[model samples]
Target: MRNAHRVEQVRAAEAELMARLPEGALMQRAAAGLAATCARLLTRRRGRVYGSRVVVLAGSGDNGGDALYAGAVLARRGARVSAVLLAPERAHAGGLAALRAAHGQVVLDQEVGLADFSRADLVLDGIVGIGGRGGLRAEAVPYARAARRGTVVAVDVPSGVDADTGEVAGVALRADVTVCFGTYKPGLLIDPGAGYAGAVQLVGIGLDLPPADVSALQHPAVAELLPEPGAESDKYRRGVVGVAAGSATYPGAALLAVAGALHGGAGAVRYVGTAAEEVVRRFPETLVTEGGPAGAGRVQAWVVGPGGGEGARQALAEALASDVPVLVDADGLTELGRLGPGALAGRTAPTLLTPHTGEAARLLAGADGGAPPPADELAAARLATARRLAAAYRATVLLKGSTTVVADPGGAARVNPTGTSWLATAGSGDVLAGLAGSLLAAGLPVLDAASVAAYLHGLAGRHAASTPGAPVTALQVAAALPAVWRQVRASATADE
Candidate 1:
């Protein structure tokens, strides 16, 4: 799992490292790393480090300080560096002195022409740090936009992103690369912000960051979480998935969902809904049940609500009330809104909710009068959201998107790293839900199951996208699963 430290947690770690080292030691290390990165960029481009125009977007904090010191390094190497001070008075005194020593000039107000920025080969964004609040101030947004016209490198974080939440409150800076100090902040890994962050580079500031309480799935974790059957294991021992999906109007959703579960390593899949006949006609191996969850009895886990229509409402309620772990998706999430988390709270089994942004917003809106915490940004952290929901009503929450987060009811959170835009196709989510259910039924813990399933699903989608604009159907995604599974296992074995 990829460890992510919160700003405060990072601050505490920084404090520890600072206390142990000489004064300004940590910042100097940070600055040195930043300088080295700029040096590499210059070298890679086969451009002159000397006489190359370098623009620093300086702000009021340590982030700007890093840029200033890095500017000093470049100045010594022969670059004509200019610091565009966004808040001249609040600039770091030490950084300013260092720049002056290295022949770096400060550009105040709009005195530095925007044309200068256009001429620069590289722009360094030091407008904000982890301590920053909200988006880029109105004065800075225009410059950030202009910098995007050139190669932009961000120090620590790209200015204007919510470091913890990845949300863009207003205007945000885009970067060619963001050189982070110490451990990664959520902004560098989570989407929207991560997308803007470009290629991430961790600068070794040498601080011993606290082990992340919440982590995203790394490649190794994905391998460990996937299922491997024993020779003695029967189809029943491997597990079976009961799918209650699709209506007569949308039998394809049933087919897709079942297709996902086929590679789930389940001995069999029991299909129950108006689409049962269709699933039976297609797969033949899937047992078609005339009734839903109750009648589809004795399965390891249940995947409910893909194309359920009005009939979805009833299937969702039944799945929630079941003892086995359940994966709720698509229409199921809508039904969850009506039944509420209350229906699943008292149950002893695990419940997984795979909701995209819109579904997540609705879930939060419904949880209105809950206990207080920091603003929504921190709360949206997987551990905070997952546990809050887990405690509020009991269920594992797998909030899906570019950064797929799986949070257990009480402890940590796992983020899935293996996904791309290709998985955005219609019926894609149905496949994911079915796969997750199969994992849950196979007896992996909810957070691990959901996250690993997501990783595998993403790999399948990637393999299935044969060409640009080529349709990646759910069945093809399913057919691609063995390749995904083999790839992970091969990687794992190679690692050892």
Candidate 2:
């Protein structure tokens, strides 16, 4: 698991660690790691660090101090280094003295900075740190835009990104790579901020932190969570997932949802909807029924919505009234807005809400009794959006997009880093809804089920779309699930 701590938590941890070490010891450790990373990148890009032209965009805080000290190290090694100070007067005194002693060129001219940024082998963006918000200052904006030729490395985070929420309010520096200190920040793992951050490298400074504010599950953790059938397990004992998706007009949604459910850990799938014939024709193993969820026999969990269309309201109500865990998606999510939190008032069982950006906006509007922000805005600030919805409904929310975020009412959140752009197909979300429902039926908690489902769904999408990925249909993603599941489980066991 990759843990992401908020800015305050990081500061507290750093302060505690700094107290135990000698003066300037922690900054030296950070600078050493930063310099080593720059050295490696320089060697890989230009074949050698010697004779390389490096420009450090030093700001007014520790971020600038780290970069200035790194510049001093690079200067001593025969690299031609220059420092462009956004706040020359407020720059770290120790770091500035060190760079000056090493003979690194320091200048205050923006034009010269731009020229160096354009020609240098590498540009270190230390103009802003995790605590910095909004966009780059006016003085640093041109330098960020001028780095068109060389690799731009950001220290801690890309300037302008909200470290805790992954929101980019204004113009932000885009980095080819971001070397983060201590641990991963939420902004590095979530979108908008994640999009600006091309690739991330973590440098440990030995700060003991608390439980993560956000986390991501890798293969081993997912493998342990996946339900495995025992010797005494039967089809019923394994799990039964009830799916109420599709209508007469859109039978493909039912086929796709059933496809995902069958491939998921559930032993059997009982589908009840208007698209019974279409589902039965494609998946003979599915126990099909034309009746509503009330008469759908026994099921460990229910997946409502998808292509429910006009029938969404009734199906969602039935599922919500049931004692079992229920996953609401697509049209069902739209209908859910009508009842607000009142619908889920006394329900004892867990309810999982899967909504894309648009649906999430509606959910927010319904709960808050006001117009919600646009889907693009919600997507840019994925963590906050998901957390808000989770808190509003008092249920688990799986916000699906470039970076899938699963947030529970209790404040625990997980970011899934497995998906590719190829997953933006028509019925892809339906597939995810069914897969997550299957995990819910298999006895996993709502948060775990949603996160693991997203992890597997993303991997399967990648497999369906070839190397580097290509366009693929939703059914292909569903078909790829078994192979991916086996690979994940096998990889986990091999590590043991």
Candidate 3:
């Protein structure tokens, strides 16, 4: 699992580490890692760091100090290093002295900064740290835009992004490489900020931090969570997933959802919707019935609402009434809003809600009885939005978009890392919902079920898209699941 800590948590860990270490030791560690990464990048780009032109955009904080000190290291190794001080009066005294001792040039003029930035082989962005808000300050704004040729390396985080929420308030510096110290910040993993951060590299500064509330599952972690049958397992022993989706008008939704469920380790997929004929025709293996979830025979878990059209409300209610785990998506999410949290009240089994940004807005609006925040805003602040919705509904939520974030009501969250934008195709959410619901039936915990579903769905999407990114239909993604699943298990076993 790749963990991300909030700024406050990072600060606390840094303070604790600093208290035990000698003064300047922690900074040196950070600087050393930063310089090494820069040196490697420089070598990759220009074949050598020696005689390379490097510019440091230094602000007033520790981030600026980290960049300045790193620049000094590069200067000592024969690189032509220069610092553009955004805040000359508040520059780190120690860092400045070190840079001067190493013969690195320092300048305070914005025009001179822009000139150096345009000509440099590398630009280290230290204009803003993790704690910064809004956009670049007036003085730093021009330089941020001036660097177009060389690689831009952001210190800890790219400036102007909300490190906790991943929201870009205004213009933010985009980095080709982001060197984060101690722990990964949420911003670097989640979207608008994630978009700004090209490649993220974490440097262990040895801060003893607590386990993260937010994390992204890697292949090994996901492999461990995958459901596998035991020696004594039978068809019924594995698990059964009941899908209540599709109407006569949109049977494709049911087909796509069933496709996902079929590959999700569930022993059987029971279909209950108006699209039973279409579903059965495409997937003869499915146990099809034209009825509501309440009368869907026995099922380990229920996936309610994908293109249910008019039947979504009743289907969602009936699924909620069941003792089995339930995953609500698409039209079900819309009906859920009308019923509010009361519909989920007094349920013993776990409930998972999967919503795209637009659906999430409606859910939030209905929960608060107010106008929902714009979908774009919600997308930017995905972490907080997922957490809030989870708490409001007292269920697990998988907020789907460029990044899929799963959040439990108690605050545990997982960000999916393997998705491609190619997943934005029609009926993709239906597939994801079915896969997640099947995992729930297979007895993974709600969070694990959602996280693993997202992980597989993303990988499958990537497989369907292939290299250079071609358009992928939802069925192609579903078809790719088994291969991705096999690859994941194989990789995991090979490691052992």
Candidate 4:
């Protein structure tokens, strides 16, 4: 797992580590890593770092100090380095002295800084640190607009991004690569801020930290969570997932959901919906049942909603009333939103809610009986939005969009890292809902089930779109799951 710490957590850990180390040791360690990464980029772009033009945009804090000190290191290696001081008097005194000693040029003029930034072989962004929120300062705004031919590397977290929440309120500098110290920040792993961060590199400064509230599952971590049948395992022993989805108008929804369930490691799928005929035609292996979830016989878990249309409310209620875990998605989310958290208040089993931003707005509005907030606004604050919905409903939530964030009511969260823009297709969500519900039936915890399903769903989407890189149908994505599952397990085993 790739863990991410919040800004406050990072600060506390940094302070504790600094107390035991020499005054400048920690900064030096960070600077050394920053310089090394820049050096490698310089080498890759050109032949060498010697005689290359390097520009440092230095602000007022230690973020600037780290950049300035790194510039000094590059200057000593025969690179032509210039430090642009946005706050001349407030810049780190030690860093300034070090740069001057190494013969690095200091530009106090804004025009000169812009010119240097536009043509330099490399530019280091230190305009704002993790604590600097809102947006870029007036003096630093020009660099964001200025066209740059070289690579831009950000120090720690990117400027103007909330390191704790990944929210970018206004304009922020986009970096080709970000070298974060100690550990990854939450902002660096989520979107809005993550979109600005092209690629991320973790440079350990050795700060002893506590458990991270947010994390991204790697292949090995996901491989461990996946279910495998033992020799004594029978069809019932593995697990059975009951899917209640689709209607007369959207019969394809049921077929897609059942298709995903079949490949989700569930030993069997019991489908109950109006689209039973269509579902059986496509996947005859499914055990078709009449009416609602209450009469669906035995099932380890229930997946409600999808293209449920008019029957969603009853199906959701029945599934929630069951003693087993339940995953609610699509139309089911709409009904749950209308009923508010009280609808799920009596349930003892785990409940997982999957909502896109628009559906998320409805869910949030339902909690307070107010007008739904704009979908775009909710999407911009993905982490907080997911956590809020989870707390309100007292369930695990998988907020799907550009970033798929799974948040449990207790505060732990996981961000899916394998998503692609190609996943925004029709019926894609239906497939995801079934896959996650199947995992829940297979006995993964609510959080793990949601997180693992998202990870695999994203990888499957990527694989389906890989061949010609064109748009793919929902069925193609579901078909790609088995191959991707094998790939994930094989890669993990090889690493072991």
lDDT (Cα, tens digit) per residue for candidate 4, span 147-251: 999999999988888888899998899999999999898999899899888899999999999999999999999999999999999777889999999998888
lDDT string for model 1 (166-191, tens) is 66677888889999998777877776
The TM-score measured for candidate 3 stands at 0.99
TM-score of each: 0.91, 0.98, 0.99, 0.99
The true-versus-predicted C-alpha distance at residue 223 of model 3, in Å, is 0.3
Q: Can you list the residue pairs that collide in candidate 4? A: none
CA deviation > 4 Å runs, candidate 3:
none
lDDT of 2: 0.92
Best lDDT among the predictions, by candidate number: 4
User: Comparing candidate 1 with candidate 2, which one achieves the higher lDDT?
Assistant: 2
Q: Mind giving the per-residue lDDT tens digits that candidate 3 earns over 1-496?
A: 8999999999999999899999999999999999999999999999999999999999998989999999999999999999999999999888889999999999988898798899999999988999899988888788667747899999999998888878898888889999999989988889988999889999999988899998989989999999999999876788999999998778899999999999999889999999888889999999987679888898999999999889999999899999999999999999998778888999999999999999999998889888878999898789999999999999999999888899999999999999899898999999998899889889999999999999999999999999989999999999999999999999999999
Q: What C-alpha lDDT do the candidate models reach, one value each? A: 0.80, 0.92, 0.92, 0.94
Taking the tens digit of each residue's C-alpha lDDT, what string does model 2 give over 8-36?
99999999999999999999999999999
Q: Which regions of candidate 1 fall more than 4 Å away from where they truly are? A: 147-149, 361-391, 466-471
User: Can you rank all candidates by TM-score, best first?
Assistant: 4, 3, 2, 1
The alpha-carbon RMSD values of the candidates against the true structure, listed in the order shown, are 3.3, 1.1, 0.9, 0.8
